[model samples]
Every structure is written in structure tokens, then in C-alpha cells.
Target chain A: MSPSVAYGTDIDERTKAAEQSATDVLTAPDIPWNLVIWNDPVNLMSYVSFVFQSYFGYSESKAHKLMMEVHKKGRSIVAHGSKEQVEQHAVAMHGYGLWATVEKAASGNETPGKGGRQRG
Target chain B: MAKAFKYGLKGISGYLEPAERDLLRGLLDDVISMLESDVRENEDPLAALIGLDMDVKQPGDRALLRLLPNVMKDDDGGSLEFRQLTERSVRESKIGALRAAALGLDKNELVLTPDDATRWSMALNDVRLVLAERLDIRDEADAEHIHSMQDWSQAEDVESYLALVYNFTTWLQESLVQAMMAARQAKS
Candidate 1:
């Protein structure tokens, strides 16, 4: 297999930076965007979790947690980064046949790891 | 009958009958054709080389749109801009995987390398996505209705046949993913 991108490995650090930036008044360019995975009937649950684990380099349990959130809540903000970063992830998700979209973090109701901070 | 894919000492492997292999090849080909772009005489060579498609519009076909979805949630302009810059490459990569997987269907004894397994998983997922759209699987309940049509003897019409095919691919993909997870665990 090709070397998986370690995007999820540094997510906690980025999330902390995002939270710190959120506290200060920020400009438009400084605002973070989210990569949201939406639930669809066609994608198998196992396949969806696999994509999260392989593509994002997320732990199996963390990937399953996000997959369940998508299944139950209809969508989940699986990652947050600069617009360019999240958009790149969105394209990768589409390539894997997962229904994904990008949105401004403030516009969405959830943030990455908002459900629980404990790592699985 | 086909065996579910499994991970073992020699990587991932599965078995499919000749008829089942032909069915999957046809499905993969269909998705590839849907993703292939039409060449225009007036298109700029440089832009095409760089994978730019300024004239690319949002796919009107529901199935096509599902495969190549809008990137942004609410901004059409933003989504279009992003699509113009990246949609061509996305379509090309998807077509590449579909074609590779189709080529691998030539034999009944399928042994896949890690890269091949990833491509096969992607190819199977795309096939299922298109089949689901045709079957009008709008929600979990609709998927359940389709999934319930597993008896091949009951395929009396096009829809029933499609439902069966969809279910078959779903089962195949689910097993492939499970095997992939097992492989990942072994490596790490």
C-alpha cells in the first residue's frame, strides 16, 4: 500500500491550536474549516470506518467512533484544518466513494473531538 | 458462489465463479464510462495536461453527482471553483482504480497485493454507489428493502436483478474491508 498520510496523527495539536485561535479575534483567513462525512445508505459501515482509519491514519477505535456518529447523527466533522487542507481531505474522501463536504468550523454545530476528548 | 475475501499468510485472496467475475467486470466498466470525460476540439491542451476543466459542470445524473460530490456544503460558487481545479483528476483516479480492478477479474482465483486490494475496495464501492442510486436507496430503510432481495431465484425483473447485484457487491466489499483491517493489524 502507498504510505498513508499521517493527517490524523497531529490532529490533537491542530485542534488545540484552533481552539487557541478561536479565543482571539481572528481574520477570515485564520478561520478553520471542517471536513464533514455524511451518512449514506450505500456505503458499508465497515468500509467507511476503514477509509477513516487508512486515509486519515486514525486509530481503529477512533475511526469507529466517528463512523458511529455519522451513522446516528447523520454527519460528523471528522477533521478540521485550513480550507485548503480540509478541501484536500474532502477530495480524498470522494475518491474513496465516501460522501464528504467542507464547511467553515463556526458554521457547523460540532467540532472535531467535541463529543469526547478521550482517545480510544 | 464466491468466497468472501480473507487475509492469510500470502496477503488477501478470494474466489469467484466465471459468471460472477463477468458481472463485476461489466459493473466496473459502466462506472468507468460514467466518469470518462468527453474530449472537446477547442479545449486548451495546457489546461487539460494540468487536469483543469474550467467548463466542467456539476453532474446532472444523480449517480454521477454522488460519486463526484460538491466539496463545499452551501457555496455553489466555491464548489464550482474547487471542482474546476480538481474534478478532472478525481474522475481520472477513480477510473484508473475501476479499470485496474476490472482487469484483475480475468481469473477466478484472485490474489491481491495491498495496493490492489485498496483499488479493488474503491472500485467495488463505486459500483455499489451507482447501483444504490439506480435502486433508489434514499435511506437505511430503502437499503434494507434492497438487501432483503438476496434470493437469486426471485430476480424476475430489472429492479430485482439490480437489487441482487447491489447486495452481492455489498457483501463482497464488506468482506474485503474486514480482510483489509486484519491485514493492517498484522502489519502494525
Candidate 2:
């Protein structure tokens, strides 16, 4: 039998298309990334607030507020910037034992995700 | 990123059921003054007195809860340092726990078998050793790490330095309310 087509698309054409798409996505200009720290079961609320205040220079009350939001909600998007900055942030956060990741900022605005909406 | 909320409703009740709040207030000042700063004697000596069924309760049962906020207040009057200290400590403590758990999850993580506990304890000790030996005072990045709730970047010794200073203070309002209940009980 000749190359069978996939149910969702023509398999041979789709495979070629998928490869092109992946490359296009990779080569796309960096849209800037965000540093997201998720709430966890191990860290103390005080500590999370502390990280924001100490590392990022957030005020005590402000840090506490952000920390509370993270505790109450599931996660908090901490910082926003270039991919390298975000990746570095994620690494630092990980080193500090926090669960962190970097992702492209949501379109339309560059606001850091402050617990309002989940980052894409 | 792990949040360990040790107490809930039951823990709350045990914390504050009697006139225990007053006794707690007494014990807290004693612990804080003794550990962090000097305590001046109160004119009414009985005012700060905190007696308890379980002597270990300090003044009552939740002295840690009462001190959380004050601990958050920066000695330098800057909240930035205060928040940083708190976050760094928790991160250090949790990382310590994680390394232990990573080797093998605790009973809660996997199943707290007798075997698991032994292994976990050993792993914890190992992590402690690594932290103690590897503290690169010269490295700003390494200096930033807090291994045992202490912020060495600020003063000195990584464990007792600020942790003890701030240990008594936390944001455990619920825990304090529970302690207050106990204080009232003791008074009654």
C-alpha cells in the first residue's frame, strides 16, 4: 500500500507541513519570556514573599500581597523580560528550590502575570 | 514550592482553648528577648507570665504564630530585606527537605515506612553537610543561599543568626488566634 493518510490529515503532506511548522516556530523572533513561579506544598508563605522582596526589591507589604496571591491562587507569574533573563530567573528559582518556568508573554501587552491570568 | 501548612482546625483548637493567649504573650517576649534581643522586666511581673500544661508550649502552644508579623518587620525599617529573609529561609528549608525527599520520598511523599524514615534522616544529614561545607562566602550567588532559615548574607552564621531573630515571628495569624484562646482559658 502507498503511504496511508492520517485520519486528521494527509499523512505525508501533514508530516512535511509539521516539520516546516516546527522550524518556523523555532526561528520566530523571541517574543520575550516570563518567569512563572508556581505555588507549592513545601515553601512557607513568608519565604515566597521574601523571595519577591529580597530578590526583586518588592516592598514587604507588596511582597506579602503577591505571596498571598500565589498561596491563594495556584501560581504567580513573577517577572517578564527577554528569554535569557527569564531562563536565568527560572534557573535561579529552581536553584532556590522553587518550581519555575519561562514562556512567551501573552500577546497585546507585556504585563507580568501577577496571578490574574495563566501565562501561555 | 511546597507549602507545608502543619495545622488545621484541630491544631487550631489545641493551640488556643483556654486563657492561654496571655501566657503565650509572656513566653513570646521571654523567647524573643532571650533569643533575639534583651528583655526588660515588666513592673507587673505576672503580666507576662505564661504557664502551661505542656512546658514545651513555651507560653501556650503557638508562640511562633504570634511573632510572625513582627518578624516580617525589618530591623532596618525596610520591608525588602524582611521579605527576602523570609523567602530565602523557606527556600533553604524546603530545598533541604527536597534533597532528602528526592533521595526517597517521606512517608507522606511515598509511604512513611520505618525504612523510609531511616533513609530520609540520612539524606537530610547529607544535605546539611553539603550546605555547611559548600557555603562560598565570596560568591555573591552562593552567599545568597540560605541553608537553615538563616540569611548569612545579612549578618553571620547561616542558621541561628536571623532565623532565631525572626523565628518567633511569622504570618500565622490563625495559629495566633488559637493561642489567644488558650491564653483566655488560662486566665479563666
Candidate 3:
């Protein structure tokens, strides 16, 4: 008596892979939102950074970088995450007295380049 | 006692400048009284709202941080402008000092916040350092630092100023949280 081993199917690896990929995409958070802070006549920049750092637990350097983005670019995306995550951050920022909001993130906007502006 | 976020713990105590000390004492008392009254008169939503708005306390880095601007305006139209500047230019010491003086405060009167001089000075210094580092104004002439906003002052203007800033901030803060929540909801 001979026992034969049978491999069920090698016919649809590609299809299975595609299905997995689709499911991953579906489960992922869609519509990236930016947590923006507008420039105001009140609310000091340092205070803004302090808020960012204290509320979000951002490092001093990270907080300052975000603050400058708000100061120079007129608004900033301090955090990027699922909608609920960003909303929580916005509320925290508000609590700290910084004007903050979340909006649809622009496409292809990569993270800060060159790090600091290297200003004199 | 151990605290998670110890924002306002001054090392030196009770060294506030005369003007600043008086302002702190006055604001502290008024806010406290209003809050207490609001608790009793919770029936009035507006009053309660105002009290909640005024109850904000940042208490970070040793500076007695209070949220919700409360400026009082008078027939003469003074002080609101000064308080407005103080809120905006929170990081500048020299400018804040000058601004305080400009708004009818004598130099000596603005010397030290009587609440706790060492702590107050340290907090002020910390604010100054942070501002200097973060403030990359294209040139030295960029807006005369932070306190330039206060060119004048009035005694009663604090409440009105606070009211305006509070309303705007509240709206924005609410909107921001809502929008973010909506996005989150959509995501989930």
C-alpha cells in the first residue's frame, strides 16, 4: 500500500493576494486630515509651542518646528492620524489655548524637509 | 505631592510687580467669586458658561496661566487693548513689561509680580528664552517683538476683551473637535 500526498491548489495565489491587499486597504483609515492652527493676533508663538508640547507630548524641537510652520506658512499640521486621533489632539490644543482644527490633508505633502530652516 | 503635568510651580514665591501683583490678585478674586456665584446660579446658562470659560487655568511653567480673556471697557475706551497684547505676546518679558508700563503702569510698579518673584522671574525668563528661539522674524524690526499690540489701556476693558476672545476660541475649539470627530467617525 502506497500513501499519496496531494497538494490541494497552486492555482490562485495571485487572486488570494489581491483579495488580502483589498481587505487591508478597506480596513485602513481613509482621508488623511491635518490638525491646523491659524495665526492669530493673540496667543503668543511660544505659548503655542508650549501648548503643542504640553498637550501632545511633543519634544521642544518638534513643538517649535510645528509653531514655525503655523507662523510662516499660516497654518500647520501638527499631527496626522485617524480622524478620532486627530480630533482628540485638536481638543487638547484648544484646551491649551491654541486655535486648532482638522482639515483634509493635501495630496503628496511629505513631512518637513531640511528639518529646520537653518535661519540665522 | 506628585503631579503628572506640573505646569505652574514657581520656585520663588510672592515677588510679583506691584501692577502685575494687583492684577493677579484682582483677577484671581474676581474669577473665583464669579465661579462661586455661577455654581449657585447654574440656572443661567450664559452666566455658567462665562464662569466655565473664565475658569481656565494653564498653570504651566510656573506662570499662572489663565484661559479666557476678561477685559473691561469703559466710556474712555482703555485697558482692553493692553490686556489683548498681554495675551498675544505672552513670551516676551521686556516687551510685556514695557507694554504693562505703557498702559498706565509705572516702571517700579511693574518691577516684579508679588505672587512669587523668583518663580515669576523664572517663568518670565523661560517664556523669553522660548520666544527668542522660536521667533525667527525675518529681521529685528519684525513687529517690535510681541507686546507691541498694547498701545493703550483701560480698566474695564478686560471683560469685553475676554468675552470676544473666549467666544471665538470656544467656537473654533468646538468646531475643530467636531470636525476631527466627524473625520474619525468616517474612518471607523
lDDT for each candidate structure: 0.88, 0.40, 0.40
Every model: Cα RMSD to truth: 5.2, 20.0, 18.3
Candidate number of the best lDDT: 1
Second chain alone, TM-score for each candidate: 0.98, 0.22, 0.22
Task: Judge candidate 1 at residue A40 and give its lDDT.
Answer: 96
Q: Please write out the lDDT profile of model 3 over residues B124-160, one tens digit for every residue.
A: 3323322322333233344244333332342247543
lDDT of 2 by residue, A14-75 (tens): 78888977975785446466677766443445455545644565555766776777777766
Better of 1 and 2 by DockQ: 1
Error of 3 at B103 (Å): 25
**Per-residue accuracy of model 1 over B1-188 as CA lDDT, tens digit each:** 99999999889999999999999999999999889845467988999999898998988999999999999878999999999999988998999999999999989999999999999999999999999999999999999899899899999999999999999999999999999999999988
Error of 3 at B180 (Å): 30
* lDDT (10s digit) by residue, model 1, range A11-89: 8977977786676446533746778999998898999988888877777888999999999999998987677878888
Provide the lowest-lDDT 10-residue window in model 1 chain B.
Answer: B33-42
The candidate, 1 or 3, that scores higher on lDDT is 1
For each candidate in turn, the interface RMSD (Å) is 1.6, 17.7, 14.4
